[model samples]
Target: MAPLSKDPATLATQGKKAMDESKYDEALTLYTAAIDIRPNSPLFYLQRSICHQRLQKGQEAVDDAEIALYLAEKLGKRDLKAQAQLRRGIGYFFLHRLGDALQCLKWSKKLDEKEKSLNLWFPKVEVGLSKLEEGDERANATVPELPDVSDKIAAEKPSTPAPVSNASPAASTAVKQATGVTTPVDKIREEMIQNNTHVTWTLYVKGVPKDKASVIMEPRSFHISFPLANGSEYSIDKDPLFAEIDVDNSRSSVLSTKIELHMKKKVEGKKWLAMEAKEEDVKAEQASAPVNKPAAAPSYPTSSRTGPKNWDTIVTDVNDDEEEGDPVNSLFKTIFKNADDDTKRAMMKSYVESQGTALSTNWEEVGKKKMEVTPPEGMEAKPYEM
Candidate 1:
């Protein structure tokens, strides 16, 4: 097929059409072309930014959205300006720029009271802001006073005529001053963790006592099946593990106690997975093993409940650009990189076979149930661009 022309309006229209059809990559290319032709058009940049976001290019998306906001403001287009602000704010939220995000979102709300679209699209922004306030910085902030909804009848009560009493004017002034006073730690945290924000947790791995080491956190919990590198038949069938995390609020942050992992023993006889020997015994085995030193074993992560350090690491890990060649990624890449080796090939094999066996035995009965739930239009799976 011939390449599309780079005319601004033509590219813009094609980009919109591609976006509508969920051809996000094509839409991005078209939008970029449109911007190339008319670099000052905020609409083109903003549209391209949406595509960048869908592709999970967080930094690029934020940059494009920011440019859109600046251009929209320069153009004096209020609606477009509000949109740009909201987009940039959402991008910031994903980038963990809580303070900047809240400022932008608040301004966007002020520009347009109808925030339903923003709320729907960016529910996490609110969650993130709320969580941030709940943490160390804004934890002590006083909540805004809500009107007493207790008594409608009292509101309608007639005011009694009072005689002017010869009271000290200074005493009245003192009472008024006292009523208006703010508390020592009552200032709200400027940075907010939005309501729908995804909270990241870290699992610290360390040796017994003080010689602590590596920490890792995955989005969700799963059984760790570490395939040993050497021919050593060592295996951990079932072991208790934990993930430590920090709970943050608008004002302050606190560490959550460890999240425990309870695994059932893979072997029928053993209740707990065992090492062939105690920690001391392992030293002997290490000495006898081949002289080629195996890579250092990953230390169990510390419990985040210990302090804010875990939270800091979590934020740092998540926010750091993967392309920057961080040591943390390299460390993780080394460990469990051979998870799908021959030794662990049966990891899901038995499970699948067992399920298949049951399905085959009950196929007829299940088929009857399936007939009732079948869609009116037959379902077909197809790969589509987005």
Candidate 2:
């Protein structure tokens, strides 16, 4: 008789426990074990997707959430299906695919309006959409500010406006002097240097005294101004940076003829072509460079029995210039490279069983009986409050 200890449901229960304790890696391993036991279980995939998201593996989270959605649909699990959609939407949000995230969130909300998680995430999806519409540079500033709904709930008397005062002759004169003040404008030449680690911008202002110059740097913007001849001011003001920078790490230096800004990137290993990058620049780069192409296999002898005979047999030949190479090991390597850790373990288990190999003595009994388990709870998983 087959032991009930290895049931997928029981393993999933243990995975949920680990997740609650913030042991995400252990939870991932347990969930993977459950998935290996029953690949068709939507719950297992959904749990693993959450683990992937917690680990900051956006692509992996997206893949698992998609698989969970498919399985939930096949099983006619409405609640699970809605949760799967929410997971996919969250995954897309993390990937910065705002359009896709909004679409998925809309569908999820339609399917389960009362779902707490859906309600919580709906605003975030809307925020992302708003960001895309307003422009990426100003997106961070576009958070939806909810009006005071409580005031509407209660009746309140309208307040009268304050009376406007006419300016006296002396006050009018002072206002005119303030408004008529003008500063001399100077020609400021700027140069930008950018790389993976940092972005440096320098502005050269001719005929400006070093003592009169001032420079201010913020996380996302900078300002530089100097007094010119005859009390006139030459200024460069409110310029946006390429990306959000470490304000603590950034510094500005004013020399006799120039002001230099050194900005350390918030995200390391990110390449910047310009001192100020827009959403269009990032999109253009992604569109030009595709990620779906399979890596080229290393060269091998055609006659080598252990090596692949034709690479085309393993993965689609993306490079038209290269001739086909070995096929045997190429297919295995391609599949292995593309598969998740759980899928690889499942394949290994099947191979070992087929070979009549003895199971490891140290392998402990995992799943005992089917156990009902709720998804891990999060503080942010509640419905939005006005």
lDDT of each: 0.42, 0.55
Estimated TM-score for each candidate: 0.35, 0.35
Model 1 residue 171 distance off true place after TM-score fit, in angstroms = 85
Q: How close is candidate 2 to the true structure, as a TM-score?
A: 0.35
Q: Write the per-residue lDDT of candidate 1 for residues 157-254, one digit (tens) a residue.
A: 22223357576999866644443212121221121111222222222221111111101112111211111112111111111112112212111111
Worst 10 residues of 1 by lDDT: 206-215
**Model 1, stretches more than 4 Å misplaced?**
121-123, 132-386
Which runs in model 2 stand beyond 4 Å of their true positions?
A: 1-5, 133-386
Clashes of 2: 9
